[model samples]
Target chain A: MSFAQPRYDGTSLALGQQSDEELMLAYAAGDLQAFCQLYEQHKNPLWRFFVRRGMATECAEELVQEVWQRVITSAPGYQPSARFTTWLYQIARNLLADQHRKAHRRFTLVSDESEALESMASQDYPDTITEQGRLALRLKHCLGKLPALQLDVFLLKEEAGLTMEQVATIMGAGLDACKSRWRYAVANLSKCIGMGAPADD
Target chain B: MTEEEKRLSALYQSLDKENSPEHVDARILAMAKQGALVHTVPLDVKQPSRWTAWRWPLSSVVSAALLVGILFFTTSPLLPPEEQAVSASSYDMVPSAPKQARREYQAMPEQKRQLAQSIEREAAAARSKTASVLPAAQISERLAEVDRLVASGELQQAGTLLMSLVEEAPEAKARLSEGQLALLQEALHRRSTNQ
Candidate 1:
């Protein structure tokens, strides 16, 4: 059976809402229930990360499975030096890299013409619209138009709620470089969405 | 600060407000159960033997017999006709000669040499194509340009140049290969290390 089937209940969700590191520690200590909770917490976001990055729905599903497989395989050896989300994102990033490399190698002839970023942009917009939807739509479009690195920095910072420091660590970039990319991403996104430069936080 | 900038920030904050989806919990639990089962079954299968003293040696004998049976089945085709005839005279010896021939084939120098040569040829062809497509001089020049920009403390310009170089080069689209795309990575690495 596909591992994509959901396995938790309302009570489990309530219990599983604990921080990732806590859940992971429990899982490492032989608490299968904790691992289930951790998986429940991350599956959708991880799925969306791949989905929004231009992976086909089937590929995204497979990637989600692979990500969890990695977690399962590595759990006994997992060290909680950072937040569990950080570790999870690190895995997601590696998987994304490998996927991109494989795709590049497979479609070497059509590499330039794939319009991956454009495809990703098209996939990110929601179907339904509300009163406040215009801005969200614009933001999604702007995010799609960003350079891949800048887009990743923006997504990790804003969507994932990672600190610039954590983003720098994840991206293997200097803090200043991360900050600079964030600034550029924000500025470019603003310009694309007909907004000016970002205000100082 | 412009009103537009404030609005954009507010918009971004709004986007970030969407909570993680509800179904993630269920998926996690399923995955955990699957993981537990994968890890638990092998131990369970081995548990009975550990509990019984006689069963352990009996299990070992059975395992060796099974191994020999498998070796005999897989290797019989490799035995010479004379060896096969001699092995056929006795049931136990029938399995042994074929297993020996298979083991010998596996360790044979000629087979290994042929495999190594094929792999080497494939690698050489791959290297040649990769080398031919990538103009080494052009890459070096771009690297030099990035170095010049960084040396002048034009960090933003260096970044832009690096980005442009990566865009222009098919190989550097991925972030992991930033070294091949630009010299900025080294400078950035040095700066971070200094910090």
Candidate 2:
């Protein structure tokens, strides 16, 4: 189920008006309003990250709430040495890692079965979707075919817009290794989508 | 650039076409407000200090020390009267009658008092022995062990050991002596520069 639509007056009094780091610092100083703004800005993109990663829609929804809760709990002591999104997805990566470890031991991976189920459940859609939406969906499906590490690198780079160095830091790998993962991810996605890469962009 | 590199670059552009959802701004603000309220409510009830984070463990240790001290003091009378007087008088003077009364009080439960005193004496002896045996040389030796770990390319292990030393050290010098800190700094500098 979708979350209730957040109400916003035109006034922009919430954290949406501020930079992520500014909002985080404000939240640290005991401003709950700042956290709400930060959450509002991140929730959908964060949810989509999990959704495109082929998590079950229900699982993605639950995980999105849990990630926000963690952000709220940690806001008081946050020290932003990097972009707020980088710090956030670092937490998300860790949670996803734990979930993968548990899931690996419990289930065989032929495909992300839960994600396939969610896609099947959403089949009653109009054919008049925007071109961008169609392309994004196609890309998402192709992304699911890559190895887990490559997919993670690709998503962090493309969706989160982290530099390769920052992605390396988050992945706990040397820079070259992260770059290689990204290269592999992109090649695999292009091939799977039958685009074989756009000629000269 | 190679075809692979070109492909990757194009893929990156394709991926960048997506935008963050419109609702994210509102959700983050709401959550921020809730978080601020949670933090403020607790402070209203009790003003927390920077050190309150350490209070649970500190208070736990203090409570344990007080408990042990009480046990030691109460069981002193169960020892031979001479030892009791020596230990008690070393700390404070009480009336001779009160001392005798303490003996009589403990005599009614001699076995329990004897068992407790035996345990207390053993604990006290163990603590004293530990204090006496911990030499500066032993601390230096531990630092040397950390250096060896660092030399072996086990930086993570070395870092963990160094962190524990910093935490447990009585003073800055004691926690990470000048030599050890210098060594650690050198290693970190080397790694960062090399990278």
Candidate 3:
């Protein structure tokens, strides 16, 4: 599922190293190559975010595609007011909320753990196993058990590699509130995975 | 913030690559390329030059001026002041067709009006001169023909004939026999009352 980046060839070479905001500004100014670069950068993280957002049992691919489509449609008016990933994720969140409303589902903070367990259980593991792989599997189980909001905060930060302020902007909350959410999400996830709460104790 | 949090974040990332599906990627990339090609395509709608941008407002102003010029010429004092005043005043009211025709008639020039009246008078005089006093035999024969038409039940035709005889006005009917005159009058009365 990895979308190998389009070769940074010819006209795209100069824009390849530009920051996400710079690339977005260029895309807004009718540079599609810059958009391709941004797309190459974000497509995976965005897809994973959709899959792990606890609604992958639904049309995760379709939702991910829709997120990219929105990115394309909204390119003309895009502003560099915040990080491009923040704006992109914010668009993703809005689409997610739209899907929720369309399904007549309430906005609750509980991940459906059974679906996550069933998906993991279907994958027969190889006899060869690494310690890190085992830990990741255990963490995935804990993620399903995490309350929906904490998992959301944790996943957004991890998936986008976003700063607290950027996460706050995407979540429509103050930075302090975002930090508080992130801290609680981390502590609870650590406890669930039997990782023992951090040195903050 | 914490080593534990970094480890947790790292574990989360390692579970799966889980990139967008191939169909999804292909679909989105195709769209992105299509959009790029669209923008890169040669455009029929050229970028507006400074003058081109102003063309609409300038054309609008020119059109408004031309309309004003036409209005001013039509209402100017070069035409008869009284006629202009009357038209301008009437234009302020919502007039019907009859009123508009009446206004035009009232606004006719005095010379034109006198010529029209003279023509009408001459036409009436010619009509009167054409109506000669008929011999008694001819009058009696015409009355007999009217009687035949009335007998045949062609009341409308009989009425038309009666109207032509009376075209010179009511006194002209005095030439007919009393019975024929009574029959013509009755036919005319029935047609008129029915209408």
* Strongest candidate by DockQ: 3
lDDT of 1 by residue, A1-201 (tens): 011223223234444365676666556656777776666566656666666554566687677777787888777666667776777777877887788798783322112323543343344445577635765777765554566667677777665667788888788889999887777666666655555533221
TM-score of each: 0.47, 0.46, 0.53
State each model's CA lDDT, in order: 0.62, 0.64, 0.70
Per-residue lDDT, model 3, residue A1, is 13
Give the docking tier of candidate 2: incorrect
Name the TM-score of chain A in model 3.
0.75
Residues B1-195, model 2: lDDT tens digits: 467656555555565433333454445456656777776665546667868978899999999999999999987567798677545642342244487856664565757756655665677677665453445776677788887987898876786576555444434344575656876676566657779
The TM-score of chain B in candidate 2 is 0.28
Model 2 Cα shift for residue B23 (angstroms): 11
On TM-score, the stronger of 2 and 3 is: 3
Model 1 segments beyond 4 Å from truth? Answer: A1-18, A105-131, A197-201, B1-9, B13-29, B39-195
Instruction: Report the poorest 10 consecutive residues by lDDT, candidate 3 chain B.
Output: B88-97
lDDT of 2 by residue, A1-201 (tens): 122223323235555566787777777777666666666576656766787777876677566666777888887667666778878888888888888887773332323433442343244436897755554556666666556777778778766777888788788889999887776565555554444532110
- Ten-residue stretch with the least lDDT total in model 1 chain B: B85-94
Model 3: CA > 4 A from native: A1-13, A107-130, A197-201, B41-195
